[model samples]
Target: MATEKLRQANTGIRSFWWWLQCIVSLLLTALLVMDRAEWIDVPGLQRLEWQAYDWRVRSTLDGQSDSSLAIIDIDERSLFEIGQWPWPRTTVAALIESLFTTYDADLLGVDIVFAEPEASHWQRHWENLVEEYPSLASLPPPTDGDQVLANTLSNYPVVLGYYFQSSVQAGDPPVIGQLPEQAHLTTDSLLSLPEPQRYTANLAILQNGALSAGFFDNPLVDADGVFRRVPMLQRWQGELYPGLPLAMLLALLGQPQIDPVIGEGSGVDQLEALDVGGFQIPVDADGSALVPWYGPRGHFEYISAADILEGRIEPGSLKGKILILGASAPGLMDLRSTPVGAVYPGPEINLGLLAGMLHQSFKAQPPWIQGFDLVNLCALGLIIVVIFPRLNAPLLMAVSGTLLLAAVGGNVWAWHQGWVLPVAGLVVLLLAQTLWHLSMNLLRETQQKRWVAEWFGQYVPPQLVKSMVESGESFGLEGEERELTVLFSDVRDFTAFSELLSPSELTRVMNRLLTPLTGAIHQHKGTIDKYMGDAVMAFWGAPLRDMKHADHAIEASFEMLAALERINREFVAEGKPTLAMGVGLNSGPMSVGNMGSGFRMAYTVMGDNVNLGSRLEGLTKVYGVSLIVSEATAKQAPDWCYRRLDQVRVKGRRAPLWILEPLGRWSTLSQERCTWHAAFETALDHYQAANFESAAQAFKELGEEDLTTQIYLARSEYFLKTPPPQNWDGVWMHTDK
Candidate 1:
């Protein structure tokens, strides 16, 4: 019996490893569920999602601007030539007249707010002159510039700009301009939304003259300061004001009525989209829409305000096009961060939004998308949990990489089709799962190798054990039939040797002898089965498969003899008793595996062939040989030299079996040994034929000191004197084991 304890030790480690995998899978699943339920919103994950979103927006842009929109920039040159900002209202009136009458622009929207009327220097001068003269007050106040600008606004289709303020002050700015009658709608399912408390609007003079007005407040600037979306409409004091871009689109669409799509559940209401005429503009639950960037900054054609005022602009440049008036001079501070550029002109953002609306290219992320993300997250996590453990390393990597591509690729395609899908969470989960599995499997295999080495390394060769471990084969230790070679060895006079020494000394002797014997077996790639007192049992083609099992077994037997000789020299030097051993080798089919009761187990071999090997070791003492091999082993190792012993039926069997004494290798044997072998074979043939006198004469000629020859001679003489039976097959029957 070998060390069966090794088999029992592995059960606990394997169980623990399996449990570890389950724990990791459960943790990942929990994380996925938490994120899906919106119970945990990871800031880093959201930030990275926005970053990926920015990249998708940039890469998916059509890079083509709408030709129907134009920007009238009061640029640096306009500031230099037309005298700084807050120019005389007459100059502003002239620019508006050029856009409407001269260029015939279809619709115009201002990104600037006339919150406070310009304090005209001429008015100051006229007031001082009148105060000094006291008689020029009847001169009509030199034509108020505010009235001139207000008159110009009244005659044209211009949308004025205003801003909503969340901060409250002691005074309230006048509410300017009329909002469309259908701008704000409240449904039965909706709740009251928070509205701004304060406003910065135009003077009553400008408000009365303007056709309509909108809030220029972009409430969707992210914490990172990127302008990604604009609120389509905002509430102030229960009144709705459209954003400048939406207001311009409404004017261009002939002031179509606004309608809010409401969805209700659990007494909570949300707006899904806004319907205008036949076009449906989708929005978030908060009524914000994702900006569809056409390209980089400066996408819209800009005509200088000074160029329009001086009539130096090209004719028909603004004709039949929507015009957005804003400032681009660095001093004006109207630049903002956007997906397309970090320092984008604010007016260009409005123009891009308006263009996106006209082309119906806005991206929407409504409430249903959250359900879509949750479904995808759970599905992807399930795939990882189920398939990761079942696949090999290369195949697992391939599956992970394919999933990553599908997640990202599908998200990009959805973005191109105007559907905003959450990609960051799915992509991160795929990558994290792959890395987690990889690291855990590596750690598991490392521990498994250490376990295998601790149990079997002493019995099996290192190279063979390493091969088994790396192959990743499972070894379920139930009994199995396999062709194997078994070896059994015992000290020739072990009982006498033990009787001469104390118990401790006998153990020392056994340790010294068994150490080199074990080394020899392992060197030949055989497994040392176990040691019983002074006897050692070993086998090959077990615990691992060895095609050269028979050859290795024979080689190990020869080495055992050599090791014994070396051991004898040391014992002689120490004035200790010398030792001799007999080894028997047999090759056949046997059952090899972990076998025993619940409390004990043994990874060993058992069969009729194994018993025959033990019987052969006992017969070695009768033949005076150190090594004996059954015919099965001898036939497999043709390159080794052997002397045929005899055909004998042992105590257990009815059929007789041939045995042989293993000599040195065939290539190393001398011609003298070959001649002797031939002569001994002839004598054995004659004896089996019942020629007693001839066989005895031939045995005496060979060697009187040869124990095998003497045994055969004695057998021949005894059989001749007894008178042979009719069915004598020349097979000796041994009565003792």
Candidate 2:
């Protein structure tokens, strides 16, 4: 019959828990939906924190080192030295010639946009130079120069930079260059066609004609109108035009021909891997590769344009080097905002190209990455589903947290290794799984509480009884414990004080004092275990384990003492009697859990250890000490200095225990007090040795404020009043209860 009753009781408990979980689950679902819809405004400042996390991950993956891409800075110094903005094309041509002839640069790529013609005077000077010198004539002719600089461009390999004009204009045909025989054409070759191609005229006449041409457009858009990624290729007039980086790569690779393979009905355009001499180049859809930007900004090397113009740098420095000319000057309009910085980022597209050349780190979203992502998501989902149903609440929570961390770590690793995994999807999955488990757990716990209350409603506190039934544990509660320092504090004369006020008046007064005291306890992470009529029992290092429990408890005790002083001043002004309290602290192991029967229970500790702690609180009165602690607590608190009082056997304990007082404000102690303490210690030594006269004299010298002074004086007076019989030990017996 008893077994049957127990089984029925458990069944009812489970049912109640299930119902509670259902309600909690519904509430959680609502919250999740609201959050997803952004009905709740999560602070925008959180994005900065997220950015910090991203930076940490990036820093960890990429060693703290600058990139090798050098920037040829057209700084303010260059502007002042080179005669202001838009220095004549001849000056630009000189800058290029100096880099090529003196620096022996391998490739020269201009980041500047030459969208307009040079002045006629500058054009004529270039023509005169070409005519005066045959070698200058050998140089590519300028398209408008009397002798076009295009002649010089043709003699030496050069790549012209231009931007793609998406805007359509009427009455003019777009200019396009003839495709070299080696370059692949999507359609049959035709020298000229009437059909309009989508392109715009180049602003700068290619006086010195370029061997190859590339578009210098960076097309990246962010949620807040910021640029984070640069598109390498964009479609125009039914043809793919490569970005600046791609154009540079091609030029550096000896103007390699590009062959594109169109997959039949797959709608996937693939580039045939090409060999530029010995180097292999990979391109993605639209015949472009993602530029591997090392970071958000300033990853490229920069050289001041003044250094090149004023002969500060050797001209040979540019030899065999792919030199990019861009402005880093603040006054120049070339500055761009990027993810890593607000300052001018130079040109990230150019930086990406330089990075690609140095490390050969090309970006491509291969077909396999999509497959990997799908597999990862499905596997994660399966794991959550299988584990969520079988595990207990605590275990379920632990596993969920672990799995979430693992998933996040995996994503970070993939991203650091140049793979862009979908982080948002994994985060959503984890949230869903956690919410599902929480809903079920809440339902189960509620049902258990109801069953518990029904079984033991008459025997235990309702709160305790509910907790026992829900948790399904009689002794062990779902909590943690550590070596906590327990403190018990009580008013000195509550009985006499209470007799003067009615019950309501007494309660109000008690609450005023307890309010500040409780606030102090919580501030130090100590939980109030229980409260007697005039005493408070609280403990540290449970529910949440803090390694600094001893320190925290001691600090809280001192804070309470200070708060009482404030309270006393207020009470004095209000014509109420001031209050004083004695606090006792002890640190040791004690069984902390739910106690009492199922219907009514309490989260309390019960053991000899707890009794000893209470006894210590009572001992505080005997020693006339504001705060007293046991030897065990004093030993653990190395940071605090304490003076030992007396050793005494309390009412029940057979063994004697050492008592101590904290040395308050040791740094500020007056020299007189220090000397008095020395005298008190001497008296204590003499008293233990049965030298009553010497002990009495030493004790007499101590001031009234010295705590040990009174204890010593009392001992001496007692011995003098009734000299101890022979063989009587120095130990003093307490005559008072």
Q: For each candidate, give its TM-score against the true structure.
A: 0.69, 0.50
Candidate 1 TM-score to native: 0.69
- lDDT tens readout by residue for model 1, 296-398: 8777898888888888977777779989899989899999988778899988888887887788888887567777888898888888888886555667799
lDDT score for residue 702 of model 1: 93
lDDT of candidate 1 at residue 521, scale 0 to 100: 93
Error of 1 at 422 (Å): 1.4
Residue 438 lDDT in candidate 1: 77
Candidate 1 deviant stretches above 4 angstroms: 1-9, 119-125, 132-140, 167-194, 261-270, 387-398, 461-589, 593-604, 609-737
- Over the stretch 1-737, how does candidate 2's per-residue lDDT look in tens digits? 34345656676766565555445444544443444344663344235424543453345434333433466778888988887888766566666667767766666666766655554756778878877886886676555432244445555565666665444479655564332112333432211111223443234346236656666655444444434445455555445455566566777766555444333324643342234434444443434444455565555667887898778996565556566778877777777655455664455446655566456565444434444655665666666655564555777789888988888788677766655454554565567667777667666656556655654443234544544544445322423345777889998887787787799988998898887887787777676788787788888765445577777888889888888889889888987777778998888887665555656555566566667777777877877778888888888777776766877777667777777887754676678767766666787778878899998988887767765677778778898888888996665554333
Pairing residues by index, what is the TM-score of model 2? 0.50
The C-alpha local distance difference test score for the whole of candidate 1 amounts to 0.81
